[model samples]
Target: MNRFTTMRILRNIVLLLTVLTNIGCDQISKDMVRKHISYYEHISVVRHHFTLTNVENTGAFLSLGNEWPSPVREILLVVLPIIALIAGLAVILFKQGLSALFRLGASCVIGGGIGNIIDRAVRGSVTDFLHLKFGIFQTGIFNLADVSIMVGTFLVMYSFYKDRNPSPKLPA
Candidate 1:
């Protein structure tokens, strides 16, 4: 194979590996939490600030549609996310001139989406365990998949910003 063809093959492999790695980490952490932690049994990780607890979210982020009917839940949470994830994977895999950072961010998003979708499809909910609170600042319970999605979104946005407003070059 030509050099360019070889490089393209390597890039595709790396992209697939990155997505799988994210999904694996997310699933592994959730599995550990499910096996070891009981529902609502809070274990303090940092005094009252960080905690480990198990809770299954039956809807989207922050349990937004938990009260919705079963059909709506399935469509919104499982079906739609699966479709979006597929499109995201295709974009990262085939889009030309995409920077490494952008591709990584998109892969992370797709991976995290798959993780949550797997839970929703098989378990009827997504497992969430970690929590944080500090004085007036606090956050809802979440898992590694949520972290991956948030970080990936931030990275993707940052990449776009950088592209639009690149740093000035210093005199050579």
Candidate 2:
């Protein structure tokens, strides 16, 4: 194998491992929460501001589509995400010339997305428990998958920010 080919293979392996690690973390955390927290139960993990609450979400982010009709909800929440995730995975794997940061972000996004999809497909809902409130700023109850998604989003955005400004051009 040529040096270039070998490096390509190594990069692919690293990306796969990163994705699997993210997914594993998400699934394990959810499993732990499922085993310990009863339905609709609340546990204060960090005083009043930060609490753990068990709740199942059957809708899109922040329960936006929770009230949608069943058929619509299924197509929008489940089918669309599966399709998008597949497309994203293809881009991450096959798309070349991407920076390492971009790959990391894509992997996290895909891993987290798949984790939630597994729950929705098998349990008919996504398990969410972590809750946070800081005065006027409050986050909807979320899970590890949510955190992964957010971190991935930030990484992706950061990559863009860094790439947008190539070092200031100086006159030759």
The whole-model lDDT of each prediction reads 0.92, 0.88
lDDT of 2: 0.88
TM-score to native of every candidate shown = 0.97, 0.93
Query: How close is each model in CA RMSD to the real structure?
Result: 0.9, 1.8
Q: List the residue pairs that clash in candidate 2.
A: none
The Cα error of candidate 2 at residue 99, in Å, is 0.9
- Worst ten-residue run, lDDT, model 1? 4-13
Could you tell me the TM-score of candidate 2?
0.93
C-alpha RMSD of candidate 1: 0.9
Shift in Å, residue 151, candidate 1: 0.9
Residue-level lDDT of model 1, residues 60-144, one tens digit each, is 8999999999999999899988988999888898888998889888888888889999999999999999999999999999998
Q: List candidate 2 stretches off by more than 4 Å.
A: 168-172
